[model samples]
Target: MKNSTLLLAIASAMLLQAAPAVAQNNVPIRKIKAVRPTTELTLLDRVESDTHRKIYQYNEYGYITSVMEYNKEAEQWVLDTDNSYRQEYVFNAAGQCTARTSFNVDKAGNKTTEKNKAEVEVIGDKTWERYYKEYPDSTTHISEAFAYDKWGNCVEEILYGYDSYSKMETIRTYNKREYSGPVDKYTDNSNYESFKNGRLLYYLKARGFDDQITMNTNELFVEEFRKIVWQTENDKLYRREYGLDRGMDIQVGSIEKNMWKSSESEFTLNADGTRPVKETVRSYDETGEVKYDYTSHTYTWDDRGRLLASFEYNESPSEVSYKGEYTYADDYAKTLSLREAIAELSCGNQIYPEDEFLQFGRIATSSYYYAEDGDKGESTYEWNADGQLTGGKWSETCITSEPDTDNPTTRTDYGETRVGYNADGHMAWKIDHSITENEFIKIEYLYDKEGIWTGEAEYDGDSWDGPWTKEGERGNARARKRLATRAATTPKFIDDMTDGSHNIENNDGVWNTNGNYNVTDGVVTGGGYQQTLASNASVPANPQYNYTDPLMPLEGEEDEEVFTNEAEAVWSYTWNPQKGDWESEWSPTEAKRVYNKDGNIVADIYDGNQTIVSTITYRLDDDGRLIEEIYSKGGNITYEYLPGTDYLLESVETAADNSRNVCHYYYSKHNYVDPTGIESIKRNDVSTPVWYDLQGRRITTPTSKGIYIVNGKKVMVR
Candidate 1:
């Protein structure tokens, strides 16, 4: 078998289909030992290596109370007292963990402790939990409270966190949910009557009973489609103005309570409740009076629920922003629409119709227009008989208005791409042609015998008659032989190029840095930087590998930690082949960076003379979620998310000329994750294992023997 089969076997073996060992049910695992053989020759000419062990202790209630780790030293197991070495837990009478403490030992034999404690309180219908963590240099306190209704449904939750180092107490999250009681039927003529009358329904702007509708009799459909958020300023300067203390018992003034920014959204749904028909959003700044920034989108859909047209609008100067229109085609000579096919399927008792069987929702053409400079573009698609996208053509026209000329200049660009698929429905090759640039490129995908994608080759021209450039060749014949030899001999620095463990860009059999100078493979050479496996043998004077690119880094120096929570100074040098060593000169294009406490880059300064080049600042909520990013150069970007969630809702980018571009993200509730359906089964030692194809489709009978998934493990069938 090949390495691809072995890799698949290892991944599939984790999904065990057998039942648990009943004999080991009452056996508590006390300790686990792991050993790895090393190649270091011992005094007696025997190999020696270190071993590791982990010891676990459990309380009477079957909860882990303590865990200790040890490493073998000179044939003796010694306690490992490094950072985060040991952990001890304290439990209450109800068998709930109340506190946890981790032990750390420094190089000077000094031990420090980090502790976390949680306290819970139960009031009338609410529960509160306060968690506190104490570190060596800082402390964090979080308070969470939840309120439940009569049916035990949590209706409200509030979370707050206080940071000692930042000396700020902030509201991390606040969310409230409302559910309607069981209703016989919906009688609201303003909203429900329109939906039943085959008219497009719009969500009402009201306080209660407007956001949701009743889907069926005696059932309430409460979906959260819109939300509003308020943000407050909590920088160091703002906290200092309030005279706040480091402790959590400080009082906050009215100035700190005032909202600095706020946003509101409205959503309108279609008739089938499948997708949104329109969305409107507005942002406000509340420094003095409210200043509004608004954007809106309206969509037109066909009878099959496919989008036909869309329009975007901005409210600052009240103008149209963008417009797009779409056209679709079907397999039936474009005569039968998808809506008619769906009607037939629904009447024929088809509850769920698969696309492979229906085959009616293929897009044909799409056109877009921008209102800023009157630019327009269009793309047309072609599909094969199997409904696979075969090729596409894109053309765009750019209009530029000149200050001195009355007539605007227009230029058009065109491009096309074609795809080829294998018998297994996997993309085999792709060719891209740019008529504007007069360039052509082709890429071919390589797969193993089992139809698993292994590598790919790229060609510069249209023909495939010359030597090709390859990448991701981990499972190929040549790479497999090299990997076997590497397994027996350990090198000083692991060469990621041939190890198949890392992704490196290889262009025409040459390893290019792709403009990133920070990468180093721990080897220095006169050519530049040769990332090769280290050995005792001397390197040839003129090696086969050539890396004489001037932009490549010969040496790198840093004044501070690069990616830590502070500023850093960096310098890079090019190779000086004449001097037979690295040059003392630095690249003027190199830059140093300064970071804030949140590890966000605050400034970028030129490294050659230490002059400020550009600055970037970020605003974040208490939960460390970025809200806005400001760039000193030209533009700023702001982000919005769904309330009490990390899912991004929208992002707006404003250019220096005050032109705004907005994007919205929508999620559907119908798409959900299915359970794995893994269950324990009785062990059968005499039964044969089942087999499946590489695509996870069950293989009923084997015509020819090859690599197949058997009993949830990949194996060769003889």
Candidate 2:
């Protein structure tokens, strides 16, 4: 058929349909991209075995336009056909880049398509929209919609397709859910797995199962998702999936996860099902060649599913090559206890590596003393009641651990930390890390009355007090300790400020907030959160500045240990050379401030180069405690103040352009005014910070360590 004939046929079908309605899966999910706006970029015009050069092109809007694969052809730009793509986009009413679609185009411009459509809508101030798309179908296609929160983070994605041919217009659905409170520290592990149909696909075994498993993805593909039916001891879970790519076997897998919470925290799981415990894997083409593989192992548990051992397998023929097994007490089948587990594991020795006794003995842990023979001859370990691997030594010297179990009353001094179990089998304690050499750490965790770890905290009593670290980490003991520290110093800052408990005294001088930022004064400072402080120290260049004092603890104060608290910083300003009416308003003008006994501001002199630009005074009025702000421009006093509400009810401003701007503001639970009466514009967005250890290995907090030019590949610093 001619191209014109095909276009006519498509037009005819469209005309027959009449409305904007898509026919019953008439468009394959693949064609969705082509119908969108298409653009292209050419990367390597050609690559040469000896003189090949690389090129990269991007769309004007900063997106990838094209990447070309080429080979050397007389050392010139010659067409190479291997891998390339063309992208398409669509704009919504606002023209802010609503959608980005993609297609794989051959050198001839023939496009191989993927028929996925992302539906978007702005829920609030968030930029990224959620997503939804239907499964691909040449005849009957459906659509899915994605939903996002204010920060452009995906909240939920639902896969929806419709069977229009059915008399009842059947709707097929799958829903992926997300936690609403904060960013996912580990999405796959902490976020339960779900299918579009709302089925919980898989739950995590521990907080960081992905890190602990250390297996490759290819191996897991065959073991877990590849299995049809799976069983784990007496418990069982069922799952199912289908895809034509599975070849003749109709690749589908289902496994039963006998999920349960275990350990002091980090709910470690032990089971035997269709899923392999740990392994790396990769796939291959029809030719008998190595594709890629993940090293993986399947963990096994005792009769009651207590973690016993892990079985590792290789790729290709899929053969078991290594194993790490554990021994549990006979009573463990009924209940898992630390003492019983320790004794049972004590007898453990490596079953395989008969010649590599050293490798075998290492897995037993130090609680049950054993020796592993290696080049250095022997290695051993020791553990306190707390289960911390406190000792690791070679034949020459040893790092031994001594548990301060002297406190028989609580039997809680499991070394430096105090440990007691909640009804839910979770551990709680005050981890003391106050000692210098010992680094005595006290991790205290709080359980809801039901014994669920509700408040986890870590404390460094010397430098700071209260809670310094608190979060929900379910697996690693170290993580739990850190959480305890955070929980200890975790103040009710946000909660207290909401009620105006730490109301700014409305005094003089720049009211610097302590490291513990709980509330802001009444002044209209920019930078911090709350609706009013949009202009005060809101400049990111001075990110360390807050309207009120910060909550950083003095070093060594926790135990008289004078630590360098210099890492903590106060707000600083940079000089901008430009100045105008509006420009001066944007500038951090010089200001005088008077503080109350509690370090709260009582009165402030808003001075722009000692010109007495404004005066913000806090006082009691007939209605209630009120803040009065008087702006002095052109020798005229423009006053505005409200008794209760943090709003400017009077006139203001004397810019060079005479642009007398006046505005009012309000506050809510999620909003507030600073001590200077400035309403914060942006909220406290805690991104990953630049991390530094004693070794000075600096890693940016966001975990996006910029690419390190090492031998051409970017690897982690630690």
Candidate 3:
């Protein structure tokens, strides 16, 4: 059977397993470690290695106090002094972290006594945090303050950085919040207010200001300042505006820097003030005085409050427009409305009801872009019975105008992708086909018995049938062995551009050796120049050449010899002023070119030259692919390609002595996959344990209500 067919059959046999449902809990985990089994026979034979291990120490209140890391050295577990360091935290009786300290090793491999510490102070409805770091050569200090309203919503915040050398304190960021009504009022879940309130909550969360504590330490503060205004009518949010400012470097007691209004966004609700119907955004220049860009998006919804269509207009130095139409499966009635889903998620409720969720299958969308030359695209997705995406196809048509002409041309591009899952619900293989390029690639994943992804192999082919060659392999287990075998057997090639063919020709079209010729009906016409260089004995490095058209003789230069063809003008000549003639220059012996079975040049050897100054040898793989080249002078170049394809991965040029790299060039294609599973996880409904703080410090428990690292994701806990 063909490799592609066999792979597809195998993938098809692997039935997709449903993702294990998770239950919400508040259980605090004391310690956690990820270990791999030493043997493939049994998973129970797990071994702890120095590569990954961590120890946690916590206080009585479930808050972490300190952490120590160890590594296996000489078969003995010891502190990883070079990388492992202690981070300690101090908390008050109220379970709030009061201070934090971290240590690290210096360049000399010595653990420095110097440390960085952050202290926090909390008063009624207000908080302040100060951070100090001392290094061998420099010290840094930062301070932040926050104020909250009666509803426990932070209304103002300011951050400052101190420069000890200059004794200057610079304001880093500032933010202010205002609401037409109490912030708590937007949480009303009544049917009449659910839609508006849900949208308001979604918007607030997207802006990183939905919660009181999280708003104070928002990382966005480091990049820009914001002024948020929420307007409500009779407890219903009607509009919200966000104004952004940047370039905060004002010193304390000094005139404030001219803060540029970087961007602004305004959202307006529908007629009943139950859903957002329009959103407008504008961007300004660095000086904030000139408006450079503007975008407005208007949305329409069905009777059930499901998004139906959206239109967008953007003016960024030029005007462009976009439109998108959405279609849901007929069974969408079984699913919650968009507004209800958002509201439920905002209230920490599961967005999907187990059994009925999959009934809402496939969402087809069509989009259009309008500008100088308009284009349109359509995308359709397929979902399995379990709501897992099985395949998808996208096609677009674009219209472009010919250069310097009013004639317009239209081209269509299309692509399709298919995904298969293993019994563990992990993706097993994926096929991506670019119909426009007549190329397709497949990636098959390998996993251990426990369904842990160990490695993957990529294959490339022209069609969906028969031939499929492995192009790449990644991961540490089986892939490593395959790579070792390949290195031992595979030959290399040198992609020499001296021939002026191959990738450069295939990608950029026929070369225009000279601009004098015009191509029409595949026939070359017009005058062409043939130049020959002559090196002066005094200045060999500076050679001179002159362009001459064989058909057009020079007016005053009758002695100039004319050539009938370009090939005859290849040799250089010297001007003999004494004899008023041109003589052939002393030239090095010609190099003999050797070709391989594939008609590719394998070597170029100059036999007459005693030193063999320009000798080079080439090596190719079994499939006639070039992999390496050697120069007589000692310098060499090695090429790597995707395992089964002609696609070059990287090229390494070694110095003449082969001791160091002279140059390196890499060309690798990267495919981006959505982090969320096939069915978008718009909101995470499961609660996982928090093991670390935002600063990447291991924390047994969260000491404050802010953002914490949970399963490698930053989650905000209220």
lDDT digits (tens) for residues 1-718 of candidate 1: 1111010101110111111122111121111111121321111001112354444333233223334445578988666654223344454565444444444544332445544444444467544445455533546454444554443444455555554665655554444443221111222211222222221111111111233232221122212222222222221000001111122221222213432434444445566544345655645544433355454777777766666777788774367788877777663422333223222222321111112122235668777788887878777777887776676777778898775688889988787767678888876666656678765556665554445444444555533232332232121344344545675453212234321223322222211221111223443232222221111111111100111111111111122122222222333334553553444344455443433435453544454543567766666666666677787888987875544544344557789888886543332211112212111111222145475777898866544534456677544332
Task: List the candidate 3 regions with Cα displacement exceeding 4 Å.
Answer: 1-129, 132-268, 279-295, 314-320, 333-362, 365-371, 400-408, 420-430, 441-718
TM-score (all chains, Cα) for each model: 0.34, 0.24, 0.37
lDDT of 1 at 367: 78
Task: Please estimate how well model 1 matches the true structure, expressed as its whole-model Cα lDDT.
Answer: 0.42
Candidate 3, 345: how far from true, in Å? 18
**Alpha-carbon local distance difference test for all models:** 0.42, 0.30, 0.43
Q: After superposition, how far is residue 292 of candidate 2 from its true place, in Å?
A: 5.8
Q: What TM-score would candidate 3 get against the native?
A: 0.37
Stretches of candidate 1 above 4 Å error? Answer: 1-296, 314-319, 331-361, 384-388, 400-409, 419-431, 440-718
Per-model clash counts, in order, read 0, 147, 7
lDDT of 2 at 661: 46
lDDT of 2 by residue, 508-569 (tens): 12232222223235322222211111011110111101111111110111222222222212
